[model samples]
Target: MNVAIIDYGSGNLRSAAKAFERAVAEAGLDIAVAVTSDPEAVRRADRVVLPGVGAFGDCIKGLNALSGMREAMEEAVHGAGRPFLGICVGMQLMASKGREHGEHRGLGWIDGEVVPITPADPALKVPHMGWNELDFTPGRHPLLDGLEPGAHAYFVHSYHFVCADPAQSLASVSYGEALTAVIGRGNMVGTQFHPEKSQATGLAVLTNFLRWKP
Candidate 1:
């Protein structure tokens, strides 16, 4: 199987590609992982991964700059039912809009908006960085198959996803207030944290994602 890790000129492409490569090997899978900006490559892949590590507006701008990239992703994931994963700001792009710098349109894959994380406590900081434990239903989703309720994942973001439907929120983390950690619907799934940087928990999720059918 072919897994396309889209290179939108925004995310940690090399690191993410390496993580997926390791996951594929560890999982004993025959998937070919490609880091490409080619839209056709995405269209032909069995699975698609979108990773981002930057401001929401900047990331979206980079994505839009790639001709046919969004449409190809839409065809592969939405039209063809292929499993899709979004990481960091890539996940945020699945929302209806992002409120960073200014209002920006998103892929609208999930019913949500990307807003700044406002912790109720003054002690908590913006750009909620570092490792945090996840709160999720262990068996609710296949992606979390081996992940426990409090699995720690690396997160670094000032913004968070606010889901319109709670059911779409597969997991969350507390940074003075509850922030979205994972979101999913149908063949699409997203992680607010960097699974590539989360070490064991990250690898486990990546492995599960490799083995995931939906």
Candidate 2:
């Protein structure tokens, strides 16, 4: 199988690539993972992963700056129905709009908006760094195949995706208030945390993604 991790000049491509490599090896899958900005490469891949770091507007600008990369992603994931995964800021880009650094347009793959996390407690943090528990929603999602409700995932973000439809939320985390942790729609899934840095829990997520069908 071929997995293409889009490199639109925003994320830690090396780390994500290495994580997928380790996941594939452990899963015993014959998979070729490529980190590329080439639109055509992404279109041909069986699975697509978009990983991003930094601000939402900046990430979207980077992706749009790449000629045809955005179109390629839309065609591959939206038109062809390929399994797609987004990590951290990458996941936020799936929202219709983001409130970070003013309102910015996103991929609109999911019906939601990205907003800054406002913890109810005054002492709570904004980035929500470190590890947090993942509380999976009822029913099974292919991406959560080997993951349990209390599995902790590494997170480092100030903004989170607030899904418009409750059914789109696959899991959530509590930090003074409940926050969306995972969102899924059909073959597409996204995580607010950095799976590459989440250790075993993250690796299991990547492994499940490699084996996921829909």
lDDT of 1 by residue, 1-214 (tens): 9899999889999999999999999888999999999999999999999999999999999999999998999999999999999999999999999999999999999988999988888988887999999998879899888888988999999999999999999999999988989999999999999989999899998888888887
What's the C-alpha lDDT at position 103 in model 2? Answer: 100
Q: What is the C-alpha lDDT of each candidate?
A: 0.93, 0.92
Residue 117 in model 2: lDDT: 91
Worst 10 residues of 2 by lDDT: 137-146
Q: Quote the lDDT for 72 in model 2.
A: 94
Best model number under lDDT: 1
> For candidate 1, which ten residues in a row score worst on lDDT?
205-214
